[model samples]
Target: MINLFRSYNPLNILWLAVLVIALRIGYIIGAPDKLEFVFVESFARLLVPVSYEYALTPFLNVLLAGALVFAQALLLNKLVNQFNLLGKPSFLPALMYVTISALFTPFLILSAPLICNFLVIWMLYKLFSLYKGDDIKSSGYDLGMIVAIGSLIYLPFIYMFLAVWIALIIFRPFNWREWIAVILGYATIFFFLAVLYYLNDRFHTFYKIWLPLGTQFPNHISINNYTYVLLAPVVFILVLSVFKLQQGFFKSYVHIRKAFQLLLIMFIIAGLSFYVKRQFQLNHFLLCVVPVAITFAYYFLYTTSKWFYESLYLLLLAGIIYFQFNTF
Candidate 1:
């Protein structure tokens, strides 16, 4: 794996960049309503304090949001690159990882938590790479601070506390100091966001946002249509891989054995999806999507390296374009 990175050609980077751009173009072309506004008005109205006469501009929000989405694609790409050594997920996998991040992950640009996604990825990377007794406490504290800032942007992102704590324990075992730092992270979000609310004169919204457990919010909603766009094929390959694992195909193959980390990441995303949906917070949240993207990237390369698997991915891409591209 180390040699692969060192020996990789510059053209490969260009190819990956071109492919990523192709994905952005395809997404813009096929987006439902295609750059035209639909329901963001309601959100814009919700962004400003009721007392403020001027609502935030939807145009600016979406334009800014588009930039964030593009940035997320880049981040997801780098994330796959950074972690690929763990699973050896490749350039194609990076594309798939990024797509899943953008496609179905919680909180799209319309949601405030987009900011959290950016911050959490960096913190998680640091957490994932930490060594034994290497200041998990400080990392956790920094993680907490990032969450506090993210929550100020979108309140529910406080949930990222779950990710931060879990990552700390999984990737780097911690002691009492780290746990305290995690607690500090949670408390900091509340304190800082409250300060923002007080300044905005919308102090009441802060309580509703922070103490969500008290509210009887309606079930979150989403349309599952066209998930076959990617899910069916990805699932089939995963099923085959699972069967192979059961049959001991991976007994001696180190990379195949290690790829289960990608599987774990995928599971985390799926679990978080249901968690977010139950709360009616259906925006494309970063937490749900980041793992999904990693899973997709891992498997995309996994399938593409085999003749049968490569054929399947081609068919899947063709089907997705056929089903999804007509709107373009």
Candidate 2:
């Protein structure tokens, strides 16, 4: 399976579809009784007046979400290759993304973070463009607005505002206007939202939108033991990827090195920002999948030991399927 996706091939799409179905087989078996069809976070409804009621059955919902995530994984693969983040173009990023997106059952469904991933990809594209562009302020504004829009879907996503500033520091010289542009662009979204609230005579509730930012970090989260067991392969792969990154850190090009640094910051911010939601959901961690997938791709593409990497990849897939079915 690893060998099949190591190269860039259009035929991989068929295999990817098959792989998606395989990963989702557990959800399909349980169907409408055990799975949820439409999941909307409380804050999501507060931010957006509309609700998503597809009127579709649970099986159809799972199928549609699987299709959407697969499509996004492919798009993310293209974005990484287009930016030369992996040093060379390959299908490994897309393959890794499809695998990781199914690591948890919550991630298997259509959720806010899944939707926000499109914004994450867009922000990354704009951030990479900074390497060659002269207009830092315009790029900063665009990134800020993208983060703002994403925050509307998942409030914790506002944390990505930090990535915009961090990317500016990585790609360009110090500029105060660039910093201010990010703030202004972020405020622009809420400004209109406030007006909508005022027009509806619910202006007082506008302040409540920021309440999540004040959530205190809990001392403990009750994670199932089996979940940790399922995480073993993922943790192992990330450790290897980090070691691999450190080994070649200095040998990479200047842009590529800085890009990886930016991604590292993104992973940290995305992971830590989950506290802002106050309610701990595995779905929130989906925010980290983009950077994590890129890191995995780097490991698979550059590692010399074919058997070791192949075994690791297969182990991850097997663990995901086993845990998915056993969870019930």
Candidate 3:
């Protein structure tokens, strides 16, 4: 039983999960009257009023996503193991990825910027997850699907396909089949969305919904705040871990450099999300956090230096202070 439990866990996954849920609860509890849920939270609220139990009602959508987060986690677990051909990674990696992803949850459709940002990260993760496969068509299809699905969520996410194509050229040379998958996947979303557009009598109004929301002025979100608490020590260790990994052959489970690829893809996603429209929100870029945390957790927990760990904790504490001050 001990071995089984150990096999299932390593560092702080459960605690992290609790913390993630708590953050959402914090938002719900501390929410100002007009605050309702964030943009996508409103999507859930659409199904049920705040007076009803969030678990059993409109909040079900959020609950569904949370459930999907686990499914996504399972897929990601398989990804790390398969990409690196490394045995199971430590639990810290899982905690970091899942919890950080959750930290960004309040943003999904929080506003246009957040929606765009989350979509970018989702596409990037899907791209990185395909690193180990030999079937170019399959990988291309996956990439295409990510582009389409993410684009459907927020149209600007379609631009993420540029990174996908570039990464394909850089990492795995392209096959025409990949292009076919991308086109097909994209067409699939359009077909359904087209149908919905007609139903809404807005087939001509694609520009209205698909158009970028007017860029809002920058709101008050300091990187220092989240970096200290929500992101914390993991960020410090993650950057150093990359340097450490570079010092040696890409030995471990990720011979294909899946985790590294994940970072690049997510960074590109985050960067592109911002460039697509400037009015960024704290929750918007969260999708990137999942992979960010994962890479950080795996690399940080396994770091060989006390200095790195200490610096990380300190930075996190700084972030916490920032969070407390901002009430973020």
Q: Best-fitting candidate, measured by lDDT?
A: 2
Per residue, candidate 1 scores C-alpha lDDT tens digits across 132-195 of: 3466677777778876665555545555666666665565545778878878866775675567
Answer with 2 or 3, whichever has the higher TM-score. Answer: 2
- What TM-score, over all chains together, does every model reach? 0.67, 0.95, 0.66
RMSD in angstroms, all models? 6.0, 1.8, 6.2
Q: Please list the C-alpha lDDT of all candidates, in the order they appear.
A: 0.51, 0.85, 0.51
Scored by TM-score, the top model is 2
Candidate 1 similarity to native, TM-score: 0.67
| Number of backbone collisions per candidate | 9, 0, 12
**What's model 3's lDDT at 210?**
41
lDDT of 2 by residue, 1-328 (tens): 8788888898998899899889998967865554443344453454545645655667877787789878888899899889888888888988998999999888887778888888888898889888888877887887888888888878888999988988988998988998999998988887887787787788887788888899998898988888899888899999999999889999998999999999999999999998887668888888899999999999999998989999999999988998888884
- Which regions of candidate 2 deviate over 4 angstroms? 32-54
Tens-digit lDDT string for candidate 3 (1-328)? 1122124453444654554454355334434434333332221222233462233333444444454454455455545554442245544444444545544334421343344444544554566655666776765666677676665554555666767776665556667677677777767766776676677666686555544535553454455444445643555456676676565426754435654664666565654464344544555565465556555545554565667565664455344334433564
lDDT of 3: 0.51
Specify the poorest-scoring 10-residue window by lDDT in model 3: 38-47
Instruction: Name the candidate, 1 or 3, with the larger TM-score value.
Output: 1
- Minimal lDDT window, size 10, model 2: 35-44
